[model samples]
Target chain A: MQRTTMDLWVGLFVVMGVIALMILSLKVGNLNVYNPSQSYVISGNFENIGGLKVRAPVKSAGVVVGRVTDIQFSTQTYDAVVTMSMDSRFLFPKDTFASILTSGLLGEQYIGLAAGGDEAMLKDGDKIMKTNSAMVLEELIGRFLFNKASEDDSL
Target chain B: MLLPRRLVSGIQHIGHRVIEGVWRLGVASRFFILVLLKSGTSLRRFNLVIRELYFTGVLSLIIIVVSGLFVGMVLGLQGYETLQKYGSESAVGTLVALSLVRELGPVVAALLFASRAGSAITAEIGLMKATEQLAAMGMMAVDPIARVVAPRFWSGVISMPFLAAIFSVMGVFGGYLVTVVFIGVDEGSYWSQMQSAVDFRFDIMNGFIKSCYFGVAVTAIAVFEGYDAPPTAEGVSGATTRTVVTSSLVILGLDFILTAFMFRGVS
Candidate 1:
């Protein structure tokens, strides 16, 4: 009987510990708490996503205001379309240009919005018209090397 | 010419031994699986296995939790020191969470359980076999595999994932406590960084899957060695040692294989 009670207590503690960890994960991990009715989705087109994964933060002027919810390729244009769900409080203007920006030299990619001072706010299902796609680091390096090689050839 | 011939003969002898060992292992594995399946219907066996899991997996929770806490703290401290060099101390949460969820948590919990549960199973089964209790059961129309081996296998299969989960959670909290309280990371930023760093798609399911495999390897090897015990005290001791060593190696090897398979596309 004593062993049984001890077992029960241990089981309870283990269950509670698991629950607490999961709760902490939810709380700390900042998993999306979706309110379908209130949230607005806006899409941005990018030539290359680079490391712009889903759930990467969407920051406006260096302050994170939303997250990247989905990424799909436009079959016709052969470009990536990233869907961002912004908090209802921060209304984006239609002219706001979304750029795929890297946090640092070797850091992960995130969507950065440069908000424009416009009267009209972007509604759900609207596309951000002007977009700056991900800058391919390798391409830049290639261009620099190519220019250097051409200069050497000229010499 | 004589030396070359002797060396060739030696190599051939080793090859033959290797094949014989592999054949023996194959037969043992089949027998083990059959015994496991047959034992499932016996209420006494079922109860014994459940009790073993409770003792082995559930009771080991305190040790897993304490170890997890220290692991998280150490990771956080080390990660923070390095990140601070780059003025990116906020990334520590990401570092800790990713490390704990991806590798440390499952591996540590498994090793801990292996030492505790693996040793116990080996000794208990080996002692039973050594004392002719196993033979007595066989005489009474009772199958030892069905009665003994199955419960340990199932217990391990069930308990490992639960223990791994517990380890991961505790480790995360340990990191959080150190970072938030000791290191002076703001509660909001610390948590936000962890959230953004850990994607459910990336870490959670893989960790659980790895733990399940570890459990299976640990239990199977331990029980196999126990069943193969010679009828002597020294033989039981040797079986216990082999059970621990073999199970640990198999667990690590399987972990590497699983990681390679899971991360094949990513890296």
Candidate 2:
């Protein structure tokens, strides 16, 4: 009787722990966001990635269809090489345009994909040809100031 | 001449303490290895580990759950107050879940485990030593390390990750209750924003790994202190206190190093 009770309680404790882990992985952590088994890899090259990071969302029409898997800096071309794991459920054409974009005024940056009218769909390991780099706020302001100075000189 | 002699003595005392500390650390490492080797017996006799699990893991659930809930509630209140200033109150879920999963969950759970279960293990083993029960076992041809120490150590190792997981889950639930149920934050945004932000591999797995490290550190310290106790009432009390203090410091230090390595460029 004593042994069974101990076993029963210990079993219950272990079960609860497992349930908690499941909740963490499913509801809280969103495990389905990037299941490698159900996804395909694609890469994009950009001149300036700014603050874009690995695991950043890749959205199409404001809905996340993929995630940034890896980000590497190409020393030869000075381009940010971004690798994304796109969900197989969502397919984009070969001429899709990929751009780094921010959500709000100062929120996390994500990759936005605008599909092009192409008959062929992109596959795994395909490199996105059309890409736009992140818009750096400081660089834009600097350019605006330089334009103003140039206009004053002209005047 | 007298002042010089006193200074020399001070230097000698400092050297002595450093050597003692180094020697004690070596002994602890040896003890940990011995416990690992003898852990086979604990597994063969599974109920031993289960019994200790009940004592340490199951018993500590109430304190862990209540504290987790309260901590989450406090975080919700504070996070909403700060986030609302930026007119981004909807991101409260993201803030609560991210912080809980990444930093607070494993760290706070380990701290609580150190105080509640770590101290208990030390006191139990220390008391056993005080009562000469360990010596009694040795006379009966039983290895005290295998019989008493290994079971407790393995139990701690097994239980810690679970305890930390439960703590994180409760904390997230508590935050949800506060932010969505009470404060009237949009439930859709609360969950969706959090789902987008919290990644399973990076945030959740890292937190789990952190808790596992804490488990090993806390239990190792607890068992070592208890085994090294002076076999007296004061010694047991002091060992219990040291178990908590040393475990807390180690947990925090290890957390810092692990966070630096794990979250270096991913943020």
Candidate 3:
């Protein structure tokens, strides 16, 4: 009887460990098991993706509403096409703006969504018309330097 | 002239000891293979393994959880201070979670397990040998290695992954307590940032796999030392010390190899 009781406790302990691992995988590792199959997919095209990778968070109004599911380069358009899976709970307008954004000045990049004032909501497989590519600091700095040089030359 | 002679003898002694150490490693590996083979018949010996697991694993829970909490808090506090300077204080959660999950989780837990359970295993087995209990079992036509040593060895292997998971999870909570509750950082960023940064396959799975390997190496060393020790009080105590010291070193060494294999492939 005592042995059986001890076995029960050990079993319970193992169960708790398994549950904690599950939480770690889902909450910490972003496995996204709760994202239902009914979620919608939307594509946005960008000239540059920066450091964005698959499984990046898609946030709307500072709340995570979905995830970046896939990223592919369109050969014909010569642009990076990003596919996002948005949860069914949230709906955005057909003209929603998709922007590549970073958490901080130098942190992981994610997709940020801003809803537009359109009456028609986005449906499955819809394309977001307005897209913002990742802002490259190097390109901005280079442009600033070039503008300063050109102005000095004109003077 | 005298100094040269002494130096020559010292070099010779060192060379001899290195060869002996290599031979001892070979012997230990052979013993491990034999024990693994014996464990094939260990189904009937599972009750014994469970009892040891209760002692070695369940009893070590307090120390593992407490240490995990403190480690996480320290990481959180340090991470917050460092990231605050760069205006990325919200990344504290990611910093703490990544550090704990990637490196410290398996390594620290295994170190503690070596000291707590690994030493206990060696001492227990050594004492049994010293008291001639193993010899008595042998006289009764029972295989002591199969019934006794194999169960303890396998139990340690089975328990390590669970211990490491608990350590990481508790550590995560400890970090949350500090960053979100105590420091007043935005709670959502703490969790969401960590979720997006740490990957399930590469970071978390590799950490657990490292623990399992450490588990096998540490327990094999512990049980082998116990069974190899001389049948005396001094021998039992010495074996216990060797188990703790040697297994700790092996765990650290294996961590480097495992980390290289687990991470170097990712570009």
Model 2 chain B weakest lDDT span, ten residues long: B1-10
lDDT of 2 by residue, B1-267 (tens): 366888999999999999999999999999999999999999999889999999989998999899889888888999999999999999998998889988898999999999999999999999999999999999999999999999999999999999989999899889988999999999999888998888888899999999999999999999999999989999999999999999999999999999999998887
| CA shift of B55, model 1, Å | 2.2
**Poorest stretch of ten by lDDT in candidate 1 chain A:** A28-37
The Cα RMSD of model 1 versus the native structure comes to 5.4
Residue A65 miss distance in model 3 (angstroms): 9.6
Q: Per-model C-alpha lDDT, please?
A: 0.80, 0.92, 0.87
Instruction: Put the candidates in DockQ order, highest first.
Output: 2, 3, 1
Worst 10 residues of 1 chain B by lDDT: B41-50
Candidate 1 ranges beyond 4 A from true positions: A1-3, A13-17, A28-45, A48-97, A104-106, A113-129, A135-155, B1-5, B42-46
Candidate 1 lDDT over A1-155, as tens digits, reads: 22576467546755765674475447544445422336788898888888888778798877767778889999988999999988787898779988999998778899999988888999988998899888997999999999999999999
Model 1, B79-140: lDDT tens digits are: 98888898888888888888888788778888888888888888888999999899999999
After superposition, the stretches of candidate 3 with alpha carbons farther than 4 Å from their true spots are A1-3, A33-101, A110-134, A152-155, B1-4, B265-267
**Distance (Å) between predicted and true CA of B219, model 2?**
0.7
- Top model by DockQ, which number? 2
Residue runs of model 2 more than 4 Å from their true location after superposition: A139-155, B1-3
Interface RMSD of each: 3.4, 0.9, 2.5
RMSD vs true structure, all candidates: 5.4, 2.1, 4.6
Clashing pairs in 2: none
